[model samples]
Target: MSSPAPFSRYEFMIAWRYLRARRAEGGVSVMTWISLIGIALGVMALIATLAVRAGFRAEFVDTILGANAHTTVYMAPQRVENEFTDDVYVVPGRIQDYDAMAAKLAELPGVERTTPIVRGQVMATANDSSNVAEIFGVSLDALKAMPRIVDPQTSQGSVEDFDKGVAIGAGIQRELNLNIGDKIKLIAPEGAKTPVGTTPRVKSYEVVYVFSAGRYDIDRTRIYMPLAEAQDYFNRENVADEIEVFVTDPEKVDDWTLPLLEAAGDGAQVWNWRDASGSFLSALDMEDDVMFVILSVLVLIASMNITSGLIMLVKNKGGDIGILRTMGLTEGAVLRVFFLCGAFTGIIGTIAGVILGVLLALNVDGIMAALNALTNGGAWQPEVRGIYRLPAELRAWDIFRAIGLSLALSFIVTIFPARRAARMNPVEALRYE
Candidate 1:
């Protein structure tokens, strides 16, 4: 085989020689430096944006999953054919044969745990003292699984008392002025069969156990009681308001839901946290998308600097390119000279930006602390009154995307300038100088 044309050396060396010439002349102009700086900054911002979105999404989702059920199943009547329903009226809290339904669902694939949760609106009181507290009635097994409720320090005592009666939230405890031995009256509206006939009923249970879920609403106003206690208090039997299912893979809800629905047959429905908290999830998605677009625009603007620098370099090296063209270098080789320079600028900028971005993200807590001290006159402290930290999760995919976008932008800017340099007439180019 014949050796490759000498044009290959010229193509590669042209960009290198031009860069060295610029560096030797006390480096490029401030504008060229500024372009490189802009590119670097743009990439940094993009990386940061991705980290913030990923971090926040992961944290919030974890919290939601920690408290809320991964997959919830609501029983439907025989006449009800829909698999899922948002209409609370369609699937009432008093679902018949709930115990039997839970057992059947447990047999389905991917079913790790099933917890029967009783949800009812009730006004609670502590010996004439009253406060609005959310009561989540769970069986002893489910209560053990619920870390938030079972873990908080309780002066009032253990959840075993809950099986005897109801437990109030810590917030309610502070608000309603309750103690371990104190009796809190639980009033729930229900339907009961009286001597005369079936009628609406109201009943009260003493507060025996206190639980805190470590969440604002829960710690302050949530109570966990025994499932049986809730049923008796609500005058409900052989009925469960909702069944919470814990699945192996959280992302595999759709895959599990289809089969679960088939097994559940006509009346059963599935509700995921994504469905329950669509607004929050939507906002999270919007934040990520909006930031991505905005940051991409910034990168685009920054990318232009690299473009301008390359274009200028082409202009400066016109005479040299003309000589090479006269020496049998293909126009294609000349075009690649500038194109490689542009690509290198993007690659270098992206690499530097990533390093700096990671450093900033890692030190955000310290940075925030410094800013708070400087601005707030040392009036602020982190990790109390709130989480007091900015979170960032550096995802590999995000890095890949950043590199792709930045380089793609860099390569795109090379097109017109590279083409112009390659298409120049050697005679015309040399005649000008």
Candidate 2:
């Protein structure tokens, strides 16, 4: 063809012609198509699984960090026995001069917000349903500072409304059948000891609003009330159990730990969110990695299809290969022709699969909702399993890794079969015909 332009154009043209040929022309069209489909399906499954895992971990981390703090300063626990009874208990040392402590914490670099919290175990009863809960007593100013604790649309009631009421979590509301403005009883077991024995302190509070932190445990067990009221109920005054410090960069919490403790002065011990939830996060990460490896096996299986197709293709084209070899086509060129056939399937299939996967990842939530609808009430309800929808997040690196692996496998699997076709003795190949 006018002395072939170079870069193995002659081989490429032959490969293209072979791809377009009919089965009656000794072309392995059916096997080629099957191999392409297998590759595509394998790639799609990998992308979807990885994206879903990434999204799940992201949402869970956000929910947990939003409800808690990046770092918390708690005093050392002090054990003390009741002077009048046999009750010996360990009470956490409270932060003194909390206003100064919060101010000091806010001055630290990377600190976003600081709030004092009073936490204690309590039992909540409403509509004849009782559940043990953790109570968080926060100042109104502090509550407003934390964006996750309040919903402006729902918490737009008068100051008087919140003065005597409390905010419960969505899970708590569902568990107790509670509604806004409804009354609930809070029973604190750590009350004063009396002549009649250690008695529990009880108080009535109205539900002002419900906050959903997107975490089941926080929503189920946490309730927030005015700092003054909680202090009154918990029998603590001018003191807080800890100072919660929010940072601008939570990923660098480890770096911020020592500096924050030093800034808060001696006797202040600092711990980051990771310290409390590290194992849980690590488990999720490990599961995500395991899923990637597991799904990659699918691609490996698909690559076998490429090998099979190329071998069949080589077998069917023996006569044509002999003719090319007689016409002075080098063994390398012959190898390239077959390699292109297999490579084309892998590259095209991977690209198509990536595009389809990205589209699915972007709209996975909607897809889950639609699926649940089709399945009817209990069939595919994510809520029944404790999540609203299946989350999906596709990262560029993850996509690249998947595509690279597929193409690499495709290229590698083509080598042996292509070499075999290249080495076919011209006389042997044509002698049968």
Candidate 3:
């Protein structure tokens, strides 16, 4: 007679029958249920954690690149030597021909836009409230082109009125109780030279626009004014403290450093966004890797329940195994049958986990909002976490990785118990029975 093919219809039927066996019949149905649930929960947790990590990283990088420059070119410090004496004096650096320099830098490959800016720190007060603010002086065109500030979706007021007044962050507006057309007084410590000393420069400007960068710190402290106005306020007339450079890809900003330097010519230095935030990004990456490993271990532990369930099933079915062996079933067929039982549980559990995890990730924002409401607010602190909301972004790779890891672990753990059942001796098993 011809030998039966591997995993034939009879083999599947027997596996199904064994899987459906009752507790009164010495089956491990209870253990099977526990193992399946454990694996499902484990996979779900892993996928959710990965989704949050990815979302946070993406949001952070987007806020940085959207609201700030990818790279900045600053005037290098200059040393002036006295021709009559062996003395040298270091003076504050300033870019005199910023317009020409900005035009030159804009022509470099990968350069998208360049803007000359004057930056200063001042105390701003309005409606009897005060807060320290960082001011950026940029041209009307550059201010209008800014990503987060100019985005109509997140920002309010008009960019056309930017030249008439200053654009303030939402946090600043809230703290100072400011609104469009409100006058905010700016107090600068450094002012015009006088016989006594440099006096504080005090000026008040109307707030024409309000914006939210989706970051608490930025929204709380940043202010934008017309470039000419900023230059005068900061005591930088016809010159810029730095030229902000926007590139096509901020991630690849380092690659353009050399060309940017050459185009900027002498008396200039370059600082990229990575230079300011590289350590933070590195910490994020390291945390992602560590979290993945820790969650994978949890998955592996969950799969251990599968091993225990299959072992119990093998022990309970020994008598039936003896009869099947004596009836001419091959060891490989027995192994395949038992393996199918464990594999089925894993496949089902993984599918359930993927479904539940994807759903949670997609609705994380709504869930967070509900949670915050239940707790009477303060559930999520944007001031501490940097973003206004909890974010979860489901990536295909993260989902696939969770599924693959769970299933692989399930199949591996099932091997030992299946092997034991396949290797059982028919004579010893029948005698015991």
Predicted candidate 3 versus true structure: per-residue lDDT over 2-57, tens digit per residue: 99999899998998888886858544888888888888888998999999999999
Candidate 3 stretches greater than 4 Å from native: 25-27, 79-90
How many steric clashes does model 2 contain? Answer: 0
- Can you list the residue pairs that collide in candidate 3? none
**TM-score against truth, every candidate:** 0.75, 0.92, 0.96
Give each model's whole-structure lDDT: 0.72, 0.82, 0.90
Ranking by lDDT: 3, 2, 1
Over 4 Å off, model 1: 1-13, 20-27, 76-93, 123-131, 147-221, 258-269, 279-283, 326-328, 363-390, 428-433
Screening candidate 1 with a backbone cut-off below 3 angstroms (N, C-alpha, C), the clashing residue pairs are 83-269, 148-213, 167-209, 171-220
Q: How should the candidates be ordered by TM-score, best one leading?
A: 3, 2, 1
User: For model 2, what is the error of residue 109's alpha carbon versus the real structure, in angstroms, after optimal superposition?
Assistant: 1.2
Tens-place lDDT digits, model 1, residues 1-433: 5535644765667676666554544334444566667778888888987887787677666656666788888765433354575333333534577777778888887888888778777677765577766667788878767655566553357667667766676678877888776777656555577898766545555667666443445556567777886776666676788888888887666677887777666777888877776797789898888898999999899888876777777777789889988987778878888787777677778888888777777776577678777887353433242223456789988888888998899889877888988998999889988
Clashes of each: 4, 0, 0
What are the per-residue Cα lDDT tens digits for candidate 2 across 367-396?
A: 877877887745445344344457888898
